[model samples]
Target: MSEKILELKNISKSFSNLIANDGVDFDLKKGEVHALLGENGAGKTTLMNILYGIYKPDAGEIFLEGKKIDISSPRDAIENGIGMIQQHFSLVPSFSVVQNVALGLKELGIIPDLSKVRKRIVELSNRYKINVDPGAKIWQLSAGEQQRVEIIKLLYVKSKIMILDEPTAILTPQEAKGLFETIREMTANGASVIFISHKLKEVLEISDRVTVLRHGKVIGTVETKGSNENDLARMMVGRDVVLKIDKKPSHPSKPILKIENLHVIGDKGIEAVKGVSLEVKGGEILGIAGVEGNGQRELGEAIYGLRNYTGNIFINGSKVRSGDVLERIKNHVAYIPQDRKADALCGGLPVYKNLFIKAFSSPVFSFNPYLFYPEKLRKPAEKLVKEFSISTSSVDQEVKFLSGGNMQKVVLAREIESEPKLIIAVHPTRGLDVGAEEFVYNVLLAQKERGTAILLIAGDLYEIFNLSDRVGVLYEGQIIGYSEPDESHIEEIGLMMAGVKNEDKI
Candidate 1:
């Protein structure tokens, strides 16, 4: 057995009334990747935060190299060769990669010469096959490139113990492959890794062992080679989960959503979407496939009246004007945005209030035309909570306090209850567990069977192929190709995603 590089004994942490971690014991050996697998709010992040010194455990002991050690702050952890890359990258948007890495280096002195920093970054990047340009500004990098920068930052700091939180959530399949290769190289170089991910396949692929957490305690730790996806999922959710969606064939009807010559500008003042035309019929899903930032956001926002666009959007054969969100809502067009907290829900409000967002003024929930009959909403909210299997102490609990999966469920329940004619779902299952994903898929398909048109803009090709009846490849702000979803079209779609147009105007 390899030497135990890190160990935690009887770790307990709590926030307010919530028990974040309960007498948790975990260990990691030298040159091995240890994964923490759990549903959101299952205490995986809490344990990692304790190890990273972001939070002090209420009761615990941490040992490094067979000697007890104190990690009181991030500074202490860094000095002790521990580092973490959070889901959100910590680099300054205005700073260069080299400058961000040189922020805390003691060797560089007060003025801090960056030439030495750049050289070391290059050396580490090449050694680990984790590619990044030292001179590039943080805002200019893609999500994958930005993640590589985070890894290089840890390498530059000489961190022997690395903690990565949901590392591949924003990456493409190719980028994830590169990251797995980098993890292998890191282990080969004798570094120990603590990987936290919702994806079970990734846990099995990158880690030597996985420790499952539920509620706030360790369920069990098992060797990766002996376990499968179902085993890990059961350990995480305490049940046998359906890992695949059983999709049914679509029966098309009249167009529920139609876009004509759409040209929408992005936040950067560029024409992100250009001359895009498409239609999604009742009982059909038109999936738009592309690498992130290929105008997917702009197109979705324009149709939902959240962005300025010189285009014509029609729902149920009626024209939807620009900046008329309420009008579109009246027309029964529902939008499931990419960022739930940012665009979809009011975080500070309770789950019940968020659920009543669209129906707040309806006669059933309103009295005297301007005020809500609070009692009228209680039963329906409780019913929605139960039907969605939302894990919450109460419907009166703040929506922000819910887990990611539960939060998404709240959003789904509210939108589906509105009974829209058309639905625009954007990255609906981005950071959910296998169990949560299965539920979302079933809900969307159920809506489809009811003849609701859907526009699915997603980064995962597998997701797109599974739910979509027709697929459109979006490249450089254009629909380069449109085809029926099938395994044989993957190669052509792959080419189109890279901005290559077929000669037949595909």
Candidate 2:
């Protein structure tokens, strides 16, 4: 029999009262793609971290090719031929792809000649059918191109076993398809892969076998062909998981939010959001759909009062040209930012404290300077945590300790619970598993039922179709076309996303 390339035996890890990884066993076969499936905070990342030497396993044994091994750090894991590409990519945005790849490797004291590295990168990219411009700055590349850079970085290091965490979270459907093909090509070249994701269809499509984790425990492992999304979701959540986003038929009323001739420059000094006009009605979710980096982020930030924008923005019959961010919020507006780590929550603070960030000065949670009562704040914080199904030990727990999805839940809980007239949710369910996505959808539907106007800016076409009452296709920072959700097709939106106008283009 072929040797198992990697083996993790009875791994367990913890952080305070949270047992991130219970006794779990995992193995990877050479030249095979093994998928790790679970809900958010189901110990998938924790387990991968233990393998990649980011965290020490309290009780476990790691074996490489039937021989026990000790991996003490990220360097150690890399030296042992294991490479990890994280969800939030670690790249110097201003540096070229080759420079970013060669940054840490320069410590080897080798001759600092980038030509050799560039040649090797080209060879690797061709071998794996992955294309990345080594001379392109990280910021100059699209999210898909940046992902290819990450994969190329691993390949440049001669990594035989590659681990990708939530690889498709930010990719469009077409980009995701390309990535799956690349994974197959890697495995074909004798590289074993550990694919970590909560996306069920992609997992079944790419993996040879699947392992489900739940609350730090390994629930089951099954052949990909023998299993289905429903079976895997049940194992991950330990229940009959509902995958559908339920909603009542959209009854859009008068326009509550309107934008006219809006234009904004991206961070790179390019015109990101072009002249665009759109309207969102009361009790409606207007989903902005497109390939990411096509001006979606800039549009959301500008409308949410985070960016300096040249345009007309009207909220509830009032012009919001001169209003500060807080002023906008006070005028019945709430924003859940796209990059949760940098913009949404304060990671160092407790969950309750983070919840009070925007509301701390508001009379609802505080009275005056040096005279604050947490009891009143705690009541609502606790209630929001429960309502959002946040899995934290307590509201007093540091926000950083919560999983990505849970931290997102805290952001949503704070933003949505206050009952704002207009809510801007940007990729609100970005990294969540099936169950959590359903919960968020239900929350949005509930808000719509309350006649709240919602602007959902997301890259996932399926999500936009499923949850939005109407979708506006954003291309080159402008709303190119608008379509009723039920009447539109994914291909139409996709074409518009690439700046192909249906009327102008044959």
Candidate 3:
């Protein structure tokens, strides 16, 4: 085994009443890819934050190269040959990759030399097989390209220890494979990596070793050679987890959602959804599979009437006007947006309020039509909290304080209980564990059985195949192909997801 390059001893952290990390110990060997696996609120992110100097450990010691080190800030960590690539890119959309790479360099003097920066960026990118146009604007690049730029920025700083958080969350299968190859190249060149992700398959493929955490404590660490998904899932969840969901065949009814020649303009003022047409029938799930930045968000927003678009959108055979959010809601359209924290819930408010938002203006819950009624919502809110199995002290607790899984349950319970005719769920199970993922699957399937039309846009193909009756591959803002989710179509669907166009099946 290689020498230990980094070590954390008895690490502990807490946020309010939550014990994020409890007396944890972790180490990374030289030139090794060490994967950290855990459930939501299981302290994976918190532990990485401590290593990257984003958070101070309540109790612990960090040792680097056999010597204790103090990492009080990100600057200190960077100075000590450590760098982190966060799940969300922190690059400026208007600036080029070269500019973003050299944004905060004390060594670059008063003015950074643009040519030198660009040359280094290209050289590092090429060396690690992280292809990117340094001069291209961040907004103009795809999600995968932007991720490569982030890696290049870290490599340019000569970082010896790298931390990647949910690195392939937005990447396609091909992109993820390429990323694993890049990690191999980086580690082969003597860089140690702390890989944190929820994707178990990729973790097994990339990491030299795996560590599972549960309930803010280290469950166990094992070699990747003999490890399997079932084992890791069991460790993380403390029991045997049913990875596969039991979904019955769909019995299609009349089309609940129909899009005709829809063209949506993205946030950047470009036509994102170009002449797209599809139908999601009642009692069926139409999964839209795509790599991120391929009109998925824009199409979803358009379908929910949150964004303006050209063409016809019909909900329950009634035309929903473009950009009419309330009209779509009145038409019984429930939207579980991609970013739940930012879009779905009010973090400052309690759980019940988040659930009560949809019926705020409805006459069923409102007496004076414009009056605030907290008491009238408590019973329903408590009922949902219990039904959804959401772990919280009370429904009055702040929504932000709950774990990611519980928060998603709040979103699901609210959307499902409203009994919408159509539900648009985008990446609904983004960072959940296998246990939580199973729960989400069961909820969606129950809704399907209840005859609610669902349009699911997700990056995980496994999820697409598990619940979707029919799958549509969206590449570069168009539906390239459609297929029934099966072993025979996996390869073809994967190809279409990577922009290889084929004939539409449905």
Candidate 1: residue 504 lDDT (0-100): 47
> Rank order by TM-score, top first?
2, 3, 1
lDDT of each: 0.88, 0.86, 0.88
The segments of candidate 3 whose C-alpha lies over 4 angstroms from its true place after superposition are 364-409, 498-506
Q: What is candidate 1's CA lDDT for residue 54? A: 89
Supply the global lDDT for candidate 3: 0.88
TM-score of 2: 0.96
Candidate 2, residue 454: lDDT:
95
TM-scores, all candidates, are 0.92, 0.96, 0.92
Per the 3 Å backbone cut-off, how many clashing residue pairs does candidate 3 have? 0
Quickly count the clashes in candidate 2. 0
Q: How accurate is candidate 1 locally (lDDT)?
A: 0.88
Best TM-score among the predictions, by candidate number: 2
Tens digit of lDDT per residue, candidate 2, span 402-439?
Answer: 88788888888888887889999899888888888888
- Local error of candidate 2 at 347, Å? 0.8
